[model samples]
Target: MPQAVRTAIVGTGHRAQLFTEGLAKRDGYDVVALCDPNSVRMAFHNRMLLAAGRRTAHLWPPARYDEMLRVERVELVVVTSVDATHDRYIEAALRAGVRVICEKPITTDAVKAQSILDTVRETGGSLSVAYNYRFNPVHRRVRQLLADGAIGTVHSVHFEWMLDVSHGADYFRRWHRDKSNSGGLMVHKASHHFDLVNWWLGAEPHTVYARGQLAFYGPGPEHGYARDYVRAHGSSAADDDPFALQLADNATMRDLYLDAEGEDGYYRDRNVFAPGVSIEDDMAVLVSYDTGATMTYHLTAYSPAEGYRVMFNGSGGRLELNVEESTFTSITLRPLWSEPVDHTVDHEHEGHGGADPRVLAALLDGEQTEGAEVADARQAALALVTGLAANRSFETGLPVRTADILKL
Candidate 1:
């Protein structure tokens, strides 16, 4: 490997900021080029680099993405593009023999997942999927306790994740609301939880049965929250709506989306309650793991509070976790005939209890992470099996065997 990884960014969207900003704080990771369809969005990132006192990178349109790799002498590609477009950028980089660090979900569906997988096998290139939740101190502790057999042989898990209106509604308003684009929340959002469960247990998902519905978001008199506007940016209807995201209020948002909208016309603040939502706001899934551990999971988008509760029933006893975002994260461990031991971590940091910084170091700085192994191309695809299975089950109304769609 070179002393500095001459990296090219595939997307200049909001999620791409994590990589751009993180690279700024690290050494031996030089961002040499920015490739995106939106020139304005690319310029926004250059401005960010300039503010950080770093040299600006040359911007290239998507048509010349491959050309940029050769011209820039790129050694790595960081993909933070739309959910569905990840595979294209990832596969291209892999085939070009350039290493890659991709944001979660790897790719939205199995086909894209398989395509990337095939490229990895062909090129033997490096691909790291950033599953940052694994780096959260609380989650790392959970893995340690479980690995120590504090909970014995785990048999079943009940995991429920709730997204508050602010964060959850944003997904509905974005391109993620389209199933074709994001593979719904099953693939878009819940892949994190699924990957966490797989990591915590060191097991693979075998089959999944699921049910989901668009009970909250989307337009309709039946949904109740429908506003008479397509987007929130300049609409009076959104003036009083609490869920409206005012891109103008946030400097980064305004620069990245609102100010750049004239170039691409992509709205950063779409009305969450408007029509065209094809994804579900409520979802439930039951998964069977290769270790014979069963998991019942549920995700609800609109919740009064945000966080998740996970209960693990094992041969010895039960271990439970309750993470309430605004409050605290608690973990209780109980062995048979033993009193429960409780642990709590102060949640002062905004980015997943400081997991973001840790993961950034692991991904950008070549630091060895202590918790769940950061996903490689194959591990990343394995994390997608349960999500893809659940997504299939959502449509078929039947249990989907993971082996049927578990391609790596």
Candidate 2:
């Protein structure tokens, strides 16, 4: 039998905790170390793992990827740091002869992305971006349906994702407010959505046209409710706020976001109508895929509920996926309220229709099933570049083709 793979995490952020916690709960894997710039987050992960009855992992001083790999001898590295810094850790892991499972969008810049890919070629280290939505059961069903011609030759798509005021406001309130770090959600947040579209269509993006703006969340009307003033709403020196993290006061908010604030000063509970926020609360785009299918996409910050509605129009028939609620059940740095609804399906798991668990399963245990479609690094890179191109188009008031931007 093959031995369990020893893995370490580079960033102790929210996604990093989710990945680590999932690893701690599952078998056939060993959690070796946790590294974060913040000692608080590192200690939090250590405590969480210890309480889970697992051995504590070695904690690095911070984002010291070189130091951790050199000393801990980790075989697999997971990169969940901020969007712009994904390439740094990924490149480091690959150079150290370690395979990597990194978060999506690779990086904000295309030129730098090509350099990382080039290094992966030289080092021969495998890399997989964690676009877990492709593993989702409902989404998996959608992909299969599209492949089986349940949705014949997908002609066009209309996908709308709206995060209500509460959820949308948090992006601007936190570190994500900076486009440089978070890539303004186009790359950070929409990468999941874009990857889903890529997987469902089983086609590469050909062209894209988009437009968006900071429609709300900055200098907006104070909508009668108290802000989750977690340290004066983005002041550099604000400590973690106990009131905002009060799970008893708001169960959903606590579980989805409050628990994960140890790693960063960013708060998941900012006021939806707070002043001085910078990220865009609204975005819209139109994409043309290589297979002659076009997709219409829209995202809004202020919505009544979270989740997505995807409608696929094909030559033979049409299919639709209505989530009706957010899939995120646990709160970390972001306060999430997963709506409770009994989904009647044969398969069930947690996170994005259980895609999260399945992804880890496949990664650790090797491919379990044949005929499962997997997106390669290049494909994932294309999706990120497509979203980035859309952001450029939105800014410049021009239509941009994905292939044109990618120069493919």
Candidate 3:
């Protein structure tokens, strides 16, 4: 066996747990440090590390990131920080001659994305974005089917994602509700869907047009959801509100956010309908691809249930994927002038339909299975810029070209 890769993860939030737990359970990775603004959150992760039978990692403040890299002899940095902050850490790691495995979107806005693009070209460094949806067995089969021409000469795509109240309301209560921090859901969430379309068609985006609004969340009587309370932790108004998240009930949320609030003043259970939300709850986007294909996509953050529907139209036939989250999933092929066929996909493991482990293996151990290839920084940028174009369109009421956002 080769030497272990000394790794450190930035940000000690919920997402960071995936890397910490995955690294602890796997070989070829020695998680040496946790960098974040809150020492309380870092210490929480340290306890988790001990529970997994791994040695505790050194906790470093965000200000001392570079020093941690040098002192710990870190070779890889897993970035799961705030969306807008991704570029800062990525640039720093690349500059320090360290490899990076970043969570999706790469960065929130246009300028940060361009900076990352420039830095990657300048340093000739290694940066992989974890678009784990691509590793889901069902999605990988779709990629294979598309490549094998099961859907020949793809022309159009339609994708609609629905987030149920329980899952969707959480976003409204968290840091993601801020547009500046997360670039709205279009950047923070829909980038995953955009990347899926880009990868499935093996094409890049051409033009994008979008319209979005905060239809349900935020403090406005018009929304019919806002409670008078700012947060749910100590408010009687939030006790009866269905949209409110009770963080004190869950051990992780309670320990990670409620108990750690004094260190960072970040609340995990804010009122979903209270004021200060800048992100949209409903979004629609239209995109044209470099391969002469077009896609119509919609995302609803206030649905009664969770699931998504994606369809592909091609000269040879049409293919459809309907997933009711963890409940039901179906893939159908309807070839022109032929009988319709159904394809079944079985999930092999837990966590995002078994995508998490596969991605962890690829990122940490450099293990690449057929149909489960990792994404490069350029691909990450393409995904990010596509969302950026949609966001620009949402503001300007005009179609924005992907090429204009960031030069790839």
Candidate 4:
């Protein structure tokens, strides 16, 4: 391992900023450049770096992010780009002999994913997908218990995760609305859930039978063809209605999505009932894994309380987890909790059941993460392959095998 991971970022959005800030506050990785096609997004991050008193010499404007890869001689690349564009930056980094740390759901389709897998094989460059949930503490505990035979031979996993309308609708509002970009909710959002199941069971998905529909969102018979619910625009409108997302209004979101809307007119706060949404708001899947274990998974977007319940049953006893009922990162505070609270960092003790900071530290410090097991590219590919197969299963109304997709 290099003394310092010379790193460059290809996307300067919310996730990119989080990784950059995490890297900046750490010792091993040096983030040399931040790049986005939108100058405003790039400038937002550059200003953030400056405010943090980090050097801005290497901050590459959106247009030059790719060009900076050659000039900066970055040894590693942290890819936080949008789902559709992830393969390009990753491919470039691998081509340039740079290791890549990509955010999850690497690509929206199988052909591109195969291409990337091939590139990684051809280049022998390290490609680590960031499935941070696996790095979370409680999930780790559950994995350990399963491995120790505390849960015995796992036979089935029953998992249900819900994102409330406020948080889930945001997906339909943003670039994720395009199936070509997001691969629907199963591949885009369920990737996290599917990956967790794979890691816990230590098995890849064999076949998937899914059923999903754009249940609540899009031009519904109830709402007619209205494009927006509030008819508001820009960051100032973020707080106008608590139930509605004002990505154009929220300063953080505005800088990332709204202000940069010029490059692409995709609104990040369109009403969930709008006519253009391309993704589903409710989904369910039955997945069979290669290890002879099976899983029944359900996801919905209209719940009042956001949280998840995953019960793992092995030959031994069963392990169950119930995430607190609330959205992971809702923009506005829900009234149930009194007083102002910073759930992101201040809740470290309760952070994903104390999995958040630990994962961050592990990713930054190169130490063994606390809860879950370490994953290689094959495991990462397996997780992704399962999610993609589930998506196909939902579409084709048939069972799609992960092995069939990978042609294994």
- Candidates in order, TM-scores: namely 0.97, 0.82, 0.97, 0.87
Higher-scoring candidate on TM-score, 1 or 2 = 1
Name the candidate that leads on lDDT: 3
What is the C-alpha local distance difference test score of candidate 2? 0.70
Clashing pairs in 1: none
lDDT (Cα, tens digit) per residue for candidate 1, span 316-389: 99999999987878999988997999866566466777788888888876788776567888778888888899
Put the candidates in TM-score order, highest first: 3, 1, 4, 2
Which is superior by TM-score, 2 or 4?
A: 4
All candidates' lDDT scores?
0.87, 0.70, 0.89, 0.73
Q: Cα miss at 75, model 2 (Å)?
A: 1.1
What's the number of clashes in each of the models? 0, 13, 0, 12
In terms of lDDT, the poorest run of 10 residues in model 1 is 343-352
Q: Which is better, 3 or 4, measured by TM-score? A: 3
Candidate 3, after superposition: displacement of residue 318 in Å?
A: 0.5
Off by over 4 Å in 1: 1-3, 221-223
How big is the positional error of residue 186 in model 2, measured in Å on the Cα after superposition?
1.9
In model 3, state the lDDT of residue 189.
Answer: 87
